[model samples]
Target: MIGRDAELAFLRRVAAEARAGRGGAAVVRREAGIGKSALLEQTARDASGMRVLRVTGLEAEAELPFAALHLLLRPARHLVDGLPWAQQAALRVAFGQGRDEAEDRFLVGLALLTLLSDLAEERPLLCLIDDAQWLDRASAEALGFAARRLGADRIAMILAARDGGNGAEPHLHGVPEVRLAGLARPDCEGLLATVAADLAPEARDRVIEEAEGNPLALIEFAGMLTPKQRAGHLVPLPLHPPQLPVVSRVERSLRDAIRLLPERTQRLLLIAAAEGTGNLDLVLRAAKESGAGLPDLEPAERGHMLRVADGRLRFRHPLVKTAAYREAPLVQRVAVHQAVARALDAEEDADRRAWHLSAAAVGPDEHTGDALAAAGDRARQRGSHASSATAYERAAQLTVSPHRRAARLAAAAEAALGAGQLRRARTAAHRGQRLTDDPPVLARLATVAAMADSELGRAAPAAHTLIDAATGVTASAPGDAAAMLATAADDAWFAGDAWFAGDHAALRRAANLLESLTPRADASLAPVIGTVRLVDGEPAVGLALMRAAVPADDRGAGTIVGTYAVFSALMTGDDDAACALAAARVDRCRERGLIGELPHALQLLTQALGCCSHAERAGSVGIPAHCGPAGRWAMTGVSVGVVRRSTRR
Candidate 1:
């Protein structure tokens, strides 16, 4: 709280921006015990009246994917019911509350953003995180992902992390950090004097020297001294005593303070620490089982180590929990985890139970892995792709069989891709590929890689990926290979990437591959055949075949076939047909909630509309021999092909 005026001011600015609907986030970085948490708490106070949500990371649960985030968002669970079904399912899957299914992880982030935006419509929202260094990978990525997209939402986030610590994950790189340094000399001296007013001059000087500028260290060290020591009864401090980090010394002081409390009281505090989140009933039950009663918690509550508020036991600072658990014996810590897991033993809460058991497991266990996999499956079915990926990844790690592990890893990779986690998808894919060379597994990896490449606008690589995959699978899965070739041909022709756009060899390869496949009576076939014919000097024949492919009614053709029809019409110089097809595709995309696909449909519609307008403008003079870009490209290409064939004859 002392010497943090500038930091507080920055937080206030963030809060003000969020309140005014221009959301922002600030990452407060400093070493442990440097008052980062204190500044965050002050920011929460400064932003009074806003809906505040607090989540603190615990080292114990840092490996549990989404643990910190689940705590951060649990209060907003009611908002899930109002999200789109996919998003709703995604959130549930992430939280382990629904059936597991592959879900777009961004969908969950979008859902959380939308939920907060919806809540902020009534009042601003403030989110505070302490010890962000220990936040799980998935939660950290998701939060950073969501934080970057909060421009128009009424949300402010303040994250506190130890600078240069193990928690400094790359996801935190872009977020602005407010590096907190030691308090000023005056502020440090003033705080010490205020807390230990009766201290003699020499003892005060000694405390200040050892305490340096760390506010927590100064206060905790001040409280550690006896009246006699404060009165200069202790020996004068050496000029250069063995130095320890202020945060470490502060933790040692906390450990000494914990030793002064009664055994049962200390045990109660340890139980609270092990549980992490202060679900009052669960903690109370765990304490009771540990032979402690409500009376035992009274001392810690009175001493300000914790407080009971609104059915939750809130820690004064997250460090208190860390210290409490850290000071406990290794066996004692294990016992407490088991006790907490036992207390949370509800069949309906299998995912959480599995997690607790996973934590308590001394070593890898296949049964536990099976439980997690089952939980993941449940989550996936509910459309929680993020959670499903996490569970599957962990399950794969725990599996004993090489083949099963590889298969699970592949599933995790696919789910990560579905969640739009490209880096994670690539990692999982590479790991799976390292384990096996099964055709199906390779196909899945290739599909995910190709999709990621296409989404990232690397059209050439994506087109090659599809073609190579098709070639690899041709003998074993001819139908699938044909489908892949069809996609490759489309990309090679119109993706607009230099690698594919002018790669005549790739186009010919795609066309030849499609030609070799046993043709099926599928709607997509017309576009494939027409595309081949158009580029093969049979423009009229290609246009006729494309026209025949169009369904009798808009309802029958569907968007995919309809979209191809629009392009074919434009190529054949039928402006009216192109306009009608493009308009219908746009309408269908909108009706189906295919928002991501709507832009493409709109782009085609715009081209079609422009062509129609130009055709009308030329009506009085008769349609121009050359019309739009597509028309010109088609006419020129076909004419050149015709001339070449005639010269050969």
Candidate 2:
């Protein structure tokens, strides 16, 4: 509020643009206590006259599917009846009101999109979600899906989260993001003066230096001192100054402030933190069981720890709720989790109940582990891979059997990979590797490692992983082994790694492995065979095989064979077909959100466009002539000499 004029102006303009029928989306991320909530509040104010909807994520409700979306759209529920019957039914199924036997997640996302578009038809819609990191996976993905597809719907979305917060949505990665930083020194000093006008020069210098220009730390530390201490008239106590970063100082302030409240009032805050949804009924139920009542909430209200609005309670800041839960005793935390778990109906909110049961567990419990695994399964079915990874990882921790724990950990790795969390996938894969050496387990781990490495641009390691996997499983799983070999050959050839293509040894090895597979009819085997044969000097046979492997319908298959097929077309002097294929591949990759495949598609499209002299359209793939794919792929003997531009960044 003090020094955010620039940010406020930008957000106001975005809102104005949305009101004028231009859809927009922005993600604001920063460290905790850096005033993300304050920025969000100002966004709501700037969106005046617009139909502003709000949803705040809660750590306790982080596992509840569609919980955040339901909260955000509850006020606009009447509009759902006007949507197409299919969309309305999809929403009902998503919210557990209808049959969920074969529910499609994309349909749920489409339903929410239509519902928002309908609302926008009446009035511009401004959706502000604070603490997006804690949004349930289904809700985060659905909201992100809608945000991406809005064209001219007069809708704007603003999301705020701490950097790397749990349950973060990847779909928002491409959205315009602003990282809020600490205030500058001059601005910090000016703000500090507003809160501590009587501070002496020496004391003020010490406080500012310790705060490191963090606005929240400056304000909290200034308030904790008396006027006399501020003016250097009284000696300060020997308490330690807050450590670096704004979040720690805020946490200390919140914890210290809560200690001033009565025992029952503090307990009430804890219960609310535990439930997270701000559902008054659920909180009251939990509070009653904990021997507290409605009167207990008054003290918190007076203390400004919470506010009641439309029969729900909201914490003053996102930090207060976090601090309350974090600072509670272990036994008390477990008891509250158990109480909330007991309150949620297992049939309706099984995922939440499972998560709460896991939270309440003090040690290994197979039943809780099984419940968590089931929750992970449900999350997977809903396309919430990241959430499924978390649930599976937790389930692994709770399982007593070594093999089952290893299997769960491996599953977590696979889910994390599917969610595009490469670091987590690597960690989970490594842990699983240490726990088991079974060939099948090793093969799965190797495949995960190879795919992650390939996405990260470490082609050699990826090829090595593929080769190892192929070697380990060739005897028992011939089809998988052949596929892995083909993948390795393509990666090596495209990456132009010296070991694979400098002398063609790697490609030969991969080809040899494929040949040993008894010449099966698997479509995947074609690209590698063709590429290896072509590179090794059998051009006619290679072109024939590659052409046959190219999928007629899937323009953006982005597979190893697909890349070679495009190259084959270009080599045959079919520049027009090649460009069209490349463009289609790019479009398909974007449509499916295949981020890992996008780079390849873009590179291929750039080459094709350059060869066709479509210079004006080169910007579409975000590449210049100097860095076209032709030169980049030339190291492996697949050069397009027609486009003789340097492929440099």
Q: Count the backbone clashes (under 3 Å) in each candidate.
A: 12, 2
RMSD of each: 9.4, 7.7
Summarize candidate 2's per-residue lDDT along 1-649 as a digit string, tens digits.
7777888888888788889989888888888767788898888976777999998887777876677888898987998787655566667756656644323345566667778888998999999998899888778877887787665679998999778877556767778887887887788789877888888876777677767667777776676776677777555433246553556766877888888888888888888898887888888887788789888989889877889989898887777888888878999999998888888864867888898889899999999999999988776665567778899999999999877888898889988887778988988988888887787777787777788888788776787778877888888888778768877887667565554453366677788788778565266567668768888888998877776665554443436656766776676566766777777776654444333455677678766776775554555543454645565344222221111111110
lDDT of 1 by residue, 515-551 (tens): 6775643555576667667776678877787777654
In model 1, the runs with Cα more than 4 Å from the true position are 13-31, 44-177, 199-212, 225-249, 252-271, 284-305, 308-311, 326-338, 378-386, 452-522, 525-570, 573-649
Instruction: For each candidate in the order shown, give its overall lDDT on alpha carbons.
Output: 0.71, 0.75
TM-score of each: 0.73, 0.73
TM-score of 1: 0.73
Clash number for model 2? 2
Instruction: Output candidate 1 Cα RMSD.
Output: 9.4
